[model samples]
Target: MFDAGLSVEEPVRGVVLLRIDRPQALNALTTASAHGMIELYTRLALRTDMRALILTGAGESAFSTGADLKERAGMDAMAARAQHMAHRLAFSIRRGFDFPVIAALNGIAHAGGAELALSSDLVLAVPHAGFALPEIRRGIMPGMGGTQALTAALGPRRAMELLLTGDALDAETALACGLVNRIVAPEALVSEALALAERIAEAPPLAVSAVTRAVRGAGQGGAEAGLALELALHQRLMASDDRLEGARAFAEKRRPVWKGE
Candidate 1:
């Protein structure tokens, strides 16, 4: 259920590594690539054991520049909208994921690439990595949910500035602004991200999903709503079999075997 230009692998149990394989094109996302992503995520939904996902690019040059404009050069207005819709659909599926999603930026993340990283629950980039939203240069806008996601990642003022200026944000500045969680070595980027994912996979899936959902909701929902959601998810988890097992394991002083209930 995979496609060309995308590589899916399970280097460790319960963690999926998805690499954009079009390094020759800077991993730019064509409409077909977006459709491929939709198909890939749809197929991944059947894997109940998956606890984490790490998205990265194939090479050291770039994570992605996004929207293969070369391919879009011939597209008419209707065709462009269709392309936009495909990318939007792919991003929507990613946004709906309950498991933690990590973007391992090996190099530059520009345009929709930046949006992709923003969509993730965590972002780990290389020390030399750069992020930018340059859609304005093309007389377009960041339509791949970047406007909202960037605003949530950065404050509204910062996001507005970046969107308007179309400037690149260095990895250090991005880290200082809380856009990236860590700045890893280029060689260690994917491995470190995968290691983190492996660690996350050790925990109970139910708790992980609930935590991601509740915390990510804070961006859109006010504090009151966020608190309400957290409480609701917590209440739901209280009755789960995994919670009972956790208690039993604590009493027994043993590692809890989570059934993901």
Candidate 2:
């Protein structure tokens, strides 16, 4: 079990949990935390048994306040650059995770914290958890891939308005705007996320990977290319060992055992 400055727990099989540990700092992302997150994600990406990941903060107060500006305060130009790179690495880690990455937003996620939540495949928020991009208030903009992901999720008009004004939106508003996939009680956040992950995990791993790849490919090309990729992936998954197990289980009237092939 790697500490990585933060804490990680796997309460459900095949679903990893990553929690931001700096609750005293409202779970802010320091350089160490950022690097640790990247490392965790990178490592998890290679695990065949890991089917999904869930990211959350330690407490109900905040998911993350984003970057730890206080930690970087008084840093020289070189150090600042290094910090920025570390932040980028954290974002890349989330992006590169092959299986589903779910964000369990237990509380407020502002600036970088909000970016992190938005980076996930699905965001399940507490009923009162708020989202915001207040970088403009700091005379800056979102440094992580927040801008791009927010734009992709919420579209240009809303993204520009939020980024330009640094306004915060409540959980209800976030759900209404399609920023979060679902909302639940603060106490139920983890359970809800885990339930969703387990449901996905129970399916054939190859089919899940194919679905993820096909959806990712759809944004890069016209329908023709997307269809071709989808068909190719479908063929590959159908011939996988897991598919045979699925067929055998169906014939036997039992649950399939996934080999993750």
Candidate 3:
């Protein structure tokens, strides 16, 4: 779990509870965490069980405060861009998963963190939680999808205000701006989010996944644009464990044990 700097929990069937486990630093993201998240998504995609995902922070203080500035203090421009791109890649792979992703924002979500929440299908936040895109203050634009997703969510004017000013919005203001679905108490956040996820999980998996693809694809470039990109990703996964398991199972005449790698 720490290998990915994330804590993955599946207490309920077909529901994944993924936490950014960096409370000491407000769950700030690092390069290793981003890469590990992408790796984890690859494994999860090979599985047939997942129906929903609840992404949140490990502690009560923050969903994430964006990238680890301390870690970035000495990074060159290329390294910094690479680190941000890793997080974006992780986000993209997660979108490929055929399920709903609910973001339970515990507290402040700034810069990259806001972009991460925008990546989810649904968002729930605590009353005191905040949202913002403060990259302008740092002189670099959002390396993730803040420019695109934020505009799509809040319209050009609202998104431009936050992007240009780096101002933060409280949970209520976020709700007013249609940035969050609802505000949950810190204690009730997980249980309620999990319950909501379980409710969605009760539906037919294939139909739900088809709907997910249709809706998620609508915001992106659409299925037609994804064909070539999908084939490229499929080719990249040709050497995965699940692929080898199929050949091995056939030769030995036994059921394949999917490694999901």
lDDT (Cα, tens digit) per residue for candidate 1, span 130-217: 9999999899899878889788878799889999999999999999989999999898888899889988999999999999998789
Using lDDT as the measure, the top candidate is 1
Error of 3 at 160 (Å): 1.0
Q: Which has the higher lDDT value, candidate number 1 or candidate number 3?
A: 1
- Give the least accurate 10-residue stretch of model 3, judged by summed lDDT: 228-237
Which ranges in model 3 have alpha carbons more than 4 Å from their true place? 219-261
Candidate 2 structure quality by residue, lDDT tens digits, 145-177: 788878877889999999999999999999998
All models: lDDT? 0.89, 0.85, 0.83
Clash list (residue pairs), candidate 3: none
All candidates: TM-score: 0.97, 0.92, 0.82
Q: CA shift at 199, candidate 3, in angstroms?
A: 0.6
Q: Output the lDDT of residue 84, model 2.
A: 81
**Candidate 1, overall lDDT?**
0.89
